[model samples]
Target: MNSEHTKTALVLGALSGLRTLSATAVLSHYLRYNSNLKIKNRRLKFLNSAGFALLSKLLATGEIAIDKSPNIPDRVRPGGLSGRTLSGALVGAAIYSINKRRIWKGALIGATSALAATFLSFYTRKQITRNTRIPDQVIGTVEDVIAVGGSVAVLEGDR
Candidate 1:
């Protein structure tokens, strides 16, 4: 097993757990850009040809805007958390596959990271905003920046 690849895959997967929707957009972009879905990666050819990267990124950006709204529900909600975990796993697999590593193991790492990050981010955000003078909107904005920046960094690491 290549530990370096494993680590990278885990980190990328965790990004998904943190912001699954946005992470999906990033990962999809990386996959689509890295591979033309020609001879090497026939399996994911549809992702590139169908413009999944473009569409997903747009949706993810929209969600980032919606996330700051007070009307947004907790990320730990059943549907939200489940989606994050699943997205993490899928992203992990995709990343590891690119590196020619153990795909399932990477997926597990991603899922675990997502579950952990969900709790950590949710509770920490709650406490920080509650105890500090910073407005929730500001904190949320910071988080959005982190999510998008981190996602881009993780995906670029593969290249």
Candidate 2:
């Protein structure tokens, strides 16, 4: 693999780890309190891993697209939603974890990041596919996955 693909894979792996952990936390909370999903801890863990893998694949694809495509958005641009989502997730999670006592507070920050990420994915998708009229399949797939993940994160609420 090229350096760009390597970097993409690394970032996706990291994001996958993060997503799995966060999903575990979210699912654990639900099972502990709600008792509705009938989901076992083991199942939750599995789901977390699966969700993370899906996210990682999409993100990895997007990263590769960035290197291969001419129309990739610049990170510094005002409307660079993909960058905002990626950076926001990292910063939001970090800030939240700093004071782990108030999980709700941290969750709120995460929710905000997720919301922003959703918008970013949508914007990036539209922009990336604009000129070509026919989006690269990989790019399109990443955008879709990001959009779905972002929405799910938001719906899960301040977890």
Candidate 3:
């Protein structure tokens, strides 16, 4: 718990798992400040290089829009879950890549947290929609707001 690597991994990983967009939000801060973190993935590096933080914001906006569409599948579904996990890990790694620490710690925690959150959030949504008679779309919109707030909160913690 005292380890910065573990602390960052658990906190960022869980938040990212809960909402993949949180990754983009947190990383955007790093990019803006020209932080010491280094992104190893080619695609991620390119995205970061190409748009600074705009790419992440665009992707996050798209995700929020898609979340309300019925045509979109559950995030817990195989493909969706995989995407969440990958994004979570990458962003987690990016968050901890500074100081030349063990980056894999962040990756593992992010992926694991994403997997767990995928199931938990999915089930919670279903239950809420079923029991409360609130439409999933409405609930999803609320979730979008939560994601944004949570992402900001996580990044604020770094200060």
Candidate 4:
């Protein structure tokens, strides 16, 4: 890819991940605290899983069209998985606020996660690159782990 395109991709990918992370963080927090939450734990877990699957697919599309020689087919850039973590957190927070009938708290939860996601994105990049595994495999497996683990963890919370 051309330098300009590469730069654009890097910026866009990072931003996408940051957005996703923040969203996930809010979701995770909301679910954890929401007393009036009606969604069954299994259903909530499924929703989280669906989000990851969609995110992965989105990344794969980006890789095919823009990444060209992606190190991993589903690896959505470097910080993407961490971003997913942020998203889970956001989900939790949102639920907390909704249950309490305090909408603003949910917004704050989302904002905080967005800010944190940037740091997480950098840390994730470091970890993925530092591992001696082949770039493609590492990226691919990391993506799968994040996508699967993020959702599964909520379901396993009782354990």
TM-score per candidate: 0.87, 0.32, 0.82, 0.40
Q: CA shift at 92, candidate 1, in angstroms?
A: 0.4
Residue range 39-76, candidate 2, lDDT tens digits: 22232243234454465446644554453465765433
C-alpha-based local distance difference test score of model 2: 0.40
Off-target runs (Cα >4 Å) in candidate 1 are 35-46
Taken over the whole model, the C-alpha lDDT of each candidate is: 0.73, 0.40, 0.69, 0.41
Highest-TM-score candidate = 1
For model 3, residues 4-114, the per-residue Cα lDDT tens digits are 556555666666656677666656656666554556554456435647577677878888887788888778878888888887787666655643555677678778877
lDDT of 1 at 152: 82
At residue 111, what lDDT does model 1 achieve? 87
Q: What C-alpha lDDT, on a 0 to 100 scale, does residue 120 get in candidate 1?
A: 84
**Candidate 3 error regions (>4 Å):** 1-5, 34-52
Question: Quick one: ranking by lDDT, best first?
Answer: 1, 3, 4, 2
lDDT of 3 at 102: 55
Ranking of models by TM-score? 1, 3, 4, 2
Model 4 Cα lDDT, one tens digit per residue, 107-158: 3444354445456654676587687565744554554345335433432442
Q: Which regions of candidate 4 fall more than 4 Å away from where they truly are?
A: 1-36, 39-93, 155-159
Candidate 1 scores a C-alpha RMSD against the true structure in Å of 2.4
Point out the higher-scoring one by TM-score: 3 or 4.
3
lDDT of 4: 0.41
